[model samples]
Target: MKSQNIRLCFNNTVKALFISALLLFNTNLFAEDLEVTGNITQLGNDWLVVQGYTFYVDQNTELRGPNGSIVQFSFYQLNDLVQVKGNNRGDGTYLATRVKLEDVPNNSNEIELTGYVSAKGTNSFDINGTTFLVDANTIFRGRRGNPFSFDMIQVGMLLEVKALLQTNGDFLATRVKAEDDNHQHGNEVEVTGLIESKSTNSIIIGQWEFFVNSQTVILDRNNLLIGFSQLNVGDRVEVKAFKQLDNTFLAVRIKLEDNPQSQIEIKARIENIIGNDITV
Candidate 1:
């Protein structure tokens, strides 16, 4: 009789175990299911790479993962998700999505650009044979293509760019980076030279070219005061600028460098002073 009782108990235990296993399998399936349409790849330690940039999709953001799991990503790891907004980096990484914490602003509206004054004057900056105007109210917040324009820009120049498009489909920039007292603090800067170029924009000591956007600027008097006509080929200068979408600049004020000074002579004659003198 005791053996028969033991057999009956074993059968009941087996049935309970089978029921427990079924419930656990269902739980796992619910946890790992994906809802969004993308691949799951490791970005870093504390982050996940969803579209292109590094983002942590926790309970804060509306983004979700397969199986309703939250995804977060990191920034300090190699092969990390790049923090760029667009797609294609020329190195086989093409993120077909645009990811951002917030929407990009219309930086094309009212810009400020600062770069070395060109021989064409702040009024006319020619690059690759294309002419662009520089003046007051030009924008400089980089929302356009390419981080920095070609190396044609210099230092110790003033550029104040506007956001208004001209009739010719170009932006109208007012000159503001030069001797303008309003922008006195942004005129001067200390920069090192790139590899072998004599141009003024700072770069690393031995590198062929330095990224211009990462360079520094000094805002002080006597840093950007040189007549545009006095500038020669391969002159080094500092600039305070406002940016446009096309990476153009409008000078606010300008100053010539005193180093390796050039001789600038001015001739003036006093004509007959014709003025209504008020005698007290």
Candidate 2:
């Protein structure tokens, strides 16, 4: 009887251990890999919020910048665009393995364009004639620096955009800020781009309409005086204007420019060299 009792106890113990191991294996099998890109809405010592999802970071988490340079957790800031790769925990949270900053700072490789939004799509918008694509990593802010999203964008709204030029000629918007023209009193706005349309008293560049008054000065590439009628569509120009009380941009000066050369540099290993032609 004593031996039978001991045997029964051991078997029960072994069964409980097997069940526990199975449960652990099942929990791990149900954990899903997760990858998300968005602005960091919140930051804490060991956690971050992106796109309304919380991700916990630990010592093993890898932090990096846009250039893939290793960074510290402290390097992240609220409103900074980031991409998080991790696995979802069963408890409605995620364990991040890597966090990467996605924003490219305003530099020579980037361009700033401010104008009225002429068009908008599901994931992109047009300002001044350039189409800017926005992804989960795009940061949108109001004039007062409050966080916003792409859904706030609408046609005819004045916006300031900072974007990087993509290899395929698309402008990938990194930041978009809503501007209130009413507060722009005496503030000068400048736009440099090809003229998209022209009228007897106004001209449109990209999508920005600038009114030309009798006081408006028009000059050629050489700074020589020119008439308003001399301007035409497709002409490259730099316009200095100010927001009028009625919210219209009134041109103070317009200068024509020679079409600038568009050049792009590519970095890749040369696969083959054949007399003035290289394959990469």
Candidate 3:
């Protein structure tokens, strides 16, 4: 748990949302669940062999499937759903304790996050059966946004979390800060000049400033598409990016977006002028 000093939002990060929906739809089609186990006998380049089974895992995956499967543990594979109790083998696979191919809890591993008091999400965010209000003062640590939205966060996304992990297992982020283009994740940076243009993949963050995904720092690329695609030129914004080794994101999801030249629509027509009310 870290201090709840920093916070970020969807409009401010470059997180790639986990496409759980895609996985769910595909997995649900499996007829009969299956499970198997064997000692992790062979470890090879980009692949693992347990008993006589073979599987692959991402280079960055913490442990193939969890349950403390660390370096060189025997492993198991599940057909439709998989659950394991074991150790990691450092080779992107896990040794097993209790291997089963049963339906994973629909909402067990899924966690609902809430920042501190100022950044509650009760107005928009909810979990299993709980809700909380959110504001700039709240925090959402760990990137857990939605993948499909392009504005949501996801796993492996870095974030400035602002709450302690309660003994009961609840994420209480007081503030959330998405990492930036340079993998830096704090404070505000000055991106000056007029936005040259705006498009889906490319956005003119500032005059002569053409920001593309790979060029800028970000947490991940999940929900960033939403934030990036909806950007408006001339809309001056201040943000911070978080970076690790090769990633970045906006610090405070977009603390301010000042677009003086854009039209403000009050209803059916685009108004040339608008008052303090964005929509009334």
TM-scores for candidates 1 onward, in order = 0.23, 0.31, 0.28
Off by over 4 Å in 1: 1-110, 121-123, 126-131, 134-155, 174-280
**Of 2 and 3, the candidate ranking higher by TM-score:** 2
Ranking under lDDT, best-scoring first?
Answer: 2, 3, 1
Number of colliding residue pairs in each model: 77, 3, 77
Task: Find the candidate with the highest TM-score and give its number.
Answer: 2
Worst 10 residues of 3 by lDDT: 17-26
Which run of 10 residues does model 2 get worst, by summed lDDT? Answer: 17-26
Q: Write the per-residue lDDT of candidate 3 for residues 1-280, one digit (tens) a residue.
A: 8668542232223232111111122222221111233334555554554323345545332344443444332343322234333322222234333433333333222222221111123333322123323345564443345222213443223333333233565534444544432331121133422344766554454222333442232222233223454455565544333222232222223323444432221111112224422211
TM-score of 3: 0.28
Superposition TM-score, candidate 2 onto the true structure: 0.31
Q: For candidate 2, list the clashing residue pairs, or say none.
A: 128-206, 128-207, 129-206
Could you give candidate 2's per-residue lDDT for residues 181-250 as a string of tens digits?
4322223466666677888899986447888875466778766567899998888787767555466777
Q: How far is candidate 1 from the true structure (C-alpha RMSD, Å)?
A: 30.1
Task: Flag regions of model 2 displaced more than 4 Å.
Answer: 1-107, 183-280
